[model samples]
Target: MKHLAALNKYFWKYRFRLLAGLVFVVLSNYFSVLAPLITKYVVNKLMLLLSPGTTHAFHESVQDPLARVLINRIDRWNFSNVVALCGVTLLVLALLRGLFMFFMRQTIIVMSRHIEFDQKNEVYQHYQRLDTTFYRSHSTGDLMNRITEDVSRVRMFTGPAIMYLVNLLALIGLSVYYMLKDNVALTLYTLAPLPLLAVTIYFVNQLIHKKSERIQALLSDLTTNAQQSYSGIRVIKSFVQEKAMLAFFRNSSEEYKTNALGLAKVEAIYFPAMSFVVGISTLLTILIGGFMYIRDPQSMTFGTLTEFVLFINMLMFPVSAIGSVASMTQRAAASQKRLNEFLRLQPEIRDKPKATPKVIAGDLHFDHVSFTYSHTGIKALTDFDLHIRKGQKVAIIGRTGSGKTTVAQLLLRMFDPDQGAVKVDGTDIRDITLKSLREQISYVPQDVFLFSDTVRGNILFGNPVATMDQVRQAAKQAVVDGEIAGFAEGYDTMIGERGVTLSGGQKQRVSIARALIKDPRVIVMDDCLSAVDARTEREIIGQLYEYLQDKTAIIITHRIFSLFQFDQVVVLDDGHIIERGTHDSLLEAGGYYADLYARQRERDERPSEEEVTQEK
Candidate 1:
């Protein structure tokens, strides 16, 4: 009940709708319960009227105290007319019940959907606010299940479970009042099985909640298995590991199935436990009421007994629904706990209360900065210091683990440094609002990520309000306009997920266009030209130097010759600056940079066997 109480605010959000739906439920129940009372009156009339010349004493005490008034009218009318009148009244009540029931579903269940929509939006919005470190520590599949499946379970609790539970309480209260008024002893007998039924439901729900939470957790694992397999399908096929991956998926699926069945087993036991109690109460009513009726009709009359059975039949619907409500209640509790936990998480990298907003000039500095990844606890950069003047173009060249990308990450404030500060334009980056800092810089990483949308949409993703002319200019600068024009729908064509439909070079160029459209104060290109041909790379570089004039730029590259045009090149090895200079100066020094340049130039000059054979 406490778990359910947490959803009251969502219900209150649509207070008018919730009130209207419950009012309809009440009206529907009024009509439904009215039918049985009419049956009780008509039956007693038939028994007495058919047995003509019965004692006036017996006729005086009909089931209803107000029956004497209706009987005086009935005496003038024949039995056939009286029975037909009751039939018409019952038919009208049934129709009214059905009409209100429809409106009840429309109001309450539909409001639940509105709440669900709001809940999912809040979860997604929070995910956006969390820093990159949160995502690196979490799995994509697990996050998806939390927002989708868990929210759905909470919705069920808000809507259908609430409706049923309310109806159950109301029906039982109303039935108890009438039962006690008619026969206290019989009502006491009927309620005897209730406590046991309640006890059974309590223990059963405990089992249900425990198993459902486990099942939901296992479902997340299964989702992760499927997501990883599909994302790495190409690699699996290339390495001939299909069978191994398939076995892994099979094992995950079996675990999910086994846990699901375990929940189903407890659910299976719950229903019969409720039904067995219902059956015992029904058997007792018939047996006890029959003996009392035979002993004296006044004490427990035939019409009275029939009416009592009808009320019990009416009570059976909500009572029988207890099994389903219990199951749903347990599942909802687990899901609500899971969703609330996620919502309560505070992002570690959020801006301070008084963080300032400022336009950046992009004069960046790393002042003896040091950082280590949270998971590995090993320093990525230690006592590292560098400074770039505003509007300067600097290149960082490093091997795979030598921390080239870490520089871009720190500048973006994806994670705060452990020891020292990162500054932009004389102010520590921690003082700047995250939105203001990120908006001033454009980053194009080595591995491109494009949404499943049109090429034009992907390019304009950074600056959604950019015009067609601006879009075309950016595309041309990145050298992807010609390829886009050849597509059947041009800019409107749907590129598949992560730009899988495009070639690697085309994907990289589109990512470059995405960054170019931002028109930011600073730009970071992290090996973004690795997929493009050497000629295209050189052309892009020539165009960038002109188009991105006066903007601070960091170009991380492996092409040693490409470093010649840069204002400065800093070579890194094992998180230390190993070499620094222009191509001419480094060559004269005959250091690591010179050796790398000579080796790459020789490799390029050497022809392949196919070219050598053709020459011969």
Candidate 2:
């Protein structure tokens, strides 16, 4: 219940619609209570005509002058006409009640939908603003469930649960007022079961809240398992572990089912218990009213007793709905708590209050920078120092785990250094806005990720405002324009999820094209061309060199490309710079760089089995 306080803003936001819905609830209940009153009037009038002796007594008993006059007019009317008028009146009341009920749903339920939309967008925007560390710690499926399933539960509280609660209050208030006005003792007796009903609901709701939290957690796990299975289906199939994965999925599903059934069992008892209590109230009304009437013949009439019975029955739905409303409220509270867990979290990285955007000129420096991954406790960079002047082509060459990629990550400000500062254009990267810093640096990571969109759309993702001509030119620079043009729909062809529709080399080329389309002052390619053959790699590098001559380029890769001479080459090993010089000078010095370049060149020169077979 406390967790649900977060939604107060949304409630206030849609206050007008809620206010109108409240009015409708009252109007609907008002007309609904009238049915019982009308029935009482018809019964009493019919009784008077049937027994002529009671007509004079009924007129004497009526205290109100207006009611007396109305009764006299009704008594003089024809018997059939009187029945027809009551029937018509009940029909009209039913219509009016239904119309207001419809309007109640229109206003309240629609407002819930609007709130749902706003909440989802709010969560998604927060997700985007959070730093990389947050994403690394959270699973995609769990994040998705919070926004989708959890938000939906909250919507039930905002819409149906709230509406029903208001309806229940209105119906009970009106019904009790009318019942008590007729007879106090009988009304008190009729409501005797309600306190006990409330106590039962309170205990049951506690159990339900506990169960709902567990169920939501299990559902998130189940969804995560399914999502992971779908995303990694290719790996499962390739490894021939289909049965193993299926068995794991079945186990998760079974656990979820068992817990859900446990919750269902609890909820199953709740409704029947509610109905039983309401039933007791109805039975008490009849028995108590009968005794009261027996004490004195004129004390309570059959028409009044029938009216009391109808009022209890009118309250039956709302009262019985207590179980459902309580359950929904508990579930919503549980879900809102889950939402608040993420919503209340402040992102690890955010623009400082006074931080202003600055234009980056690509004069990069890593001054005694050191960083260790908090999750893994692995130091990726150790007092790493480097400097690159504006418009310089610097290639950082290293083997795997040599921290080559860390350089690119630092330059892009994905994570702040623990010990030192990264600067762009002689300004500490932290001094400028994160958006401004990231926008100027185009980083094509080793693991290329592409959205499920058209080839042109994926390319345009780097720069949404890039012209089609610019897109084609960027693709050409990456040497992927020819491959894209070969597709059936050319640029419009949908590249499946993560560019699965394309081959490894083709995907890498497209990723490079995406980076190129940014046209940033600093471009970092972290082994983005590892998939392409040497010939295509050379062509891409040649075209990129021409296109990026004015912009700073930092190429992080294990392989040494001898096609073009770079301005500087830094060799890294075990989070330290082992060698640093131009490619020719490093090869002349015969250090780690020289050895790596030699081995790579040897592998490249080695002939394939196909070539030997062709010679034979």
Candidate 3:
């Protein structure tokens, strides 16, 4: 309930609709209560007409002049006429009740749907704003469940649960007021079972809250298992572990089933319990009203007893709904609590209040920067320092886990350093807006990611305003224009998820084209060419050299591109810089860079086994 308070603003947003719905609830209940009173009037009139001898006495017993006139007119009417009148009146009341009920649902339920839409958008937008660290700590399944399933539960509370709750209160207040007006003692007895019913509901709801929380948690786990299994289906098939995966999923499903059944068993008690309470109220109304009538016929009439019984029966549906409303409320509370957990989380990285957008010239510098992953507690960079002037091309070559990617990440401001600052154009990056910083720098990661879209669309993502000619030109520079042209639809061909429809080298080249399309001041290619063969790689380097001459480029890779002359070459090892000089100077020094270049050149010079077999 406390967590559900987060939706207060949405409720306030739709306050007018909710207020209209409330008025309809009251109007609907008013008509509903009128039917029982009309039935009482009809029954009393029928009795007077049937007993002709007592007709005069009934008229004499009526003290009010208004009632006397009404009774006399009803007495003159025929039996069939009286029956028809009562039927018509009840029908009209039912029609009115149904109309208002429709309006009630229209306002309340529709508002709930609007709130659901807004809440989902809020969660998704927050997810987008969150830092990478948050994503690393959370699973995709759980995130999906919160926005979808949890929001749906909250919607039930906002719409149906609230509507029914209002309906129950309106019906009870009207029915009880009329019952007491007719006879106090009988009304008290008729309502005696209600207090016990309330107590029962209270205890039952506590159990329901606990069980509902467990069920929601289990459902999230189940959804996560299914999502993970689907995403990793290829891996499972490759490993021949389908059976093992199925067994794991089956275990989770069985546990969820057991808990769900337990909750159902608990919920199953509510209806019977409610029915039994209602039955007791009905029995009390009959017995007590009969005794009071027998003791004094004038004090309690037959019509009065029928009316009291009708009131009790009218309360049955609302009383029965109490358990269900409570169940929904509990479930909604549990879900709202889960939703609040993520909604309240502030992203680790955000622009300062006074930060302003600025155009960048790509004079990048890492001054005594050090960073360790909080999740893994592994120091990736230690006092790492570098300086790249504008329009300079630098290559950082290192083995795996040598902090090569960390430089790109820091430059992009994905994670701020713990010690030193990253600067662009003599300004600390933290002072610049994230959108501005990222827009000027294009990054092509080692692991390329592509949307399930046309090849043209994926390339245009880097610059939505770029022309088709620019897209083709960028692809040509990346050496993927020929491969794309060979496709049946050329640039319009739809790629599978993560570009599964394309080969590994094709995906990397497509990513390179995406980066190139941006025409950014700074382009960081982090081992993006690893998937392509040496020949293709050299061809791409040849094309990129001219295109990147005016742009600042930082190429991070393990392999050295001997053909591409870089202004500066850096050798990194174990989070420290081992060498920094021109490629020729590093080669002359005969250090780690020299050794690595030697090995790669030797491997390239060696002939393939297939070529030797062809020679034989």
Candidate 4:
């Protein structure tokens, strides 16, 4: 029930529909309780004809003075006609039950759908609000599981759990009222065995809750493992580790199965025991009532016994439903706790309370900024002080793990620096609204991620309202226009998931085009051109040189062909800025920058074996 506290907003929103559904449930229960009443009259009337003295005994049993008048409606009519009349009345009540059930299901079930729609989007939007730090610690598959399976579990509570719980209470209330009216002694006798059912259910409910939590946790791990394996299938294949990966999957899957089987075993023990307890109630009712009937029809007549037995049978569902209802409640509560923990996370990198929507002027500065990744506990950048005036171009060159990308990340405010401040136009980035700050910057990362959409759509994702001309122009600048044109549907052609259908170089080109379309005030390209060959890289950089003159740009790459185009070059080593100068000045220093430039030049100038053979 505490888990449901999070869903109060949704419940309040659909309160009217839920209220109407409950009204229908009340009407349905009213109609449902009428069947036993109808059967009671039919039995009493038949008994009156079969055994004439039984009716006078029945009159003595009830304190009602008009018991004969109420019980003997067919005194002037024959048995068959009266039986037909009772049958018709029963049929009409059954029809009304069906009608009310339809309305109840329509309002409640459909309201569940509406709640699902809103809750799913709310979770998705919360994900969007979360910063890169949250994602760094959270797995993709776990988030996916929370959004999909977790939402479905909560939705079950909204639909079947809610509908049945209320209806069960109403049915039990009405049935008890009618049963007590007929014979209070039998009603008390029927309830004597119910405490045993409640005791059994209480222990089973605890087991169900614990087992369900374990099963759901195992499922999250399994989903995360499976998703990572699929995403990294190419790595596994290249290393010929298919069997190894499959074995790992098998182990995780087997563990999940084992946990699930344990829960199933608990349910197996529970449902049968619950049914047996309900059966005890029925057996006790029949045995004692039969004895009473044999002794005297006045105390418990055949009609009253028949009606009482019918109501005892009705108790079967509420008793049996304890297991299913408990199972759903436990699963949903476990999922809710997981989802709430994630949703409750406030982003470390977000707009401050008094943050202003300041338009960036592109004067960037990292004032002795230092940062350490939380998971690794290793400093990615240390005392990194750098500045770039508006419309200046800067190139960052560093060895692997030298923190070239961390600089770009800081500029984008993906992860705030642990010490010192990153300022834009003389104001701390934290002082500016994240939307306005990020909106002014266009970043193209080393690993490109494209949506499963047409080439044009992917390009336009940077600016959804971009014109087709702008799209084609950005493609041309990235030197991918010819490839797009060659596609059968050109810009309309659908790309596979994450652009997996495209070659690596092609994907990089499309990513570049996307960033280009944004036309941001500040642009960051973090080793984005490594996939393209020397010739295409040169062409793309050449085309970008003119357009980027009026915008601040940061290029992070190992390649040095376009190094001279930048106004400044900064060299990083072990999270420290070891060298800083223009390309010529850095080469003159004859340090890390010069050594790296020489290595790149050698690789680019080296020819393939075919060219060497031709010379021979």
* The candidate that achieves the highest lDDT relative to the unseen native structure: 3
What's the ranking of the predictions by TM-score, best on top? 2, 4, 3, 1
What is the lDDT, from 0 to 100, of the residue 380 in candidate 2?
91
lDDT order of candidates, top first: 3, 2, 4, 1
Tens-digit lDDT string for candidate 4 (222-285): 8999899888888999999999988998999999899899999999998898889878888988
Instruction: Report lDDT (CA) for all predictions.
Output: 0.84, 0.88, 0.90, 0.86
> Who wins the TM-score comparison?
2
Model 1 residue 333 CA deviation (Å) reads: 1.1
Off by over 4 Å in 3: 53-76
Q: Write the per-residue lDDT of candidate 1 for residues 360-461, one digit (tens) a residue.
A: 988999888888989777678877788888988888987888888888999999989998899999899999999999998999988899999999999999
- TM-score for candidate 4: 0.96
Model 3 Cα RMSD, 1 decimal: 2.5
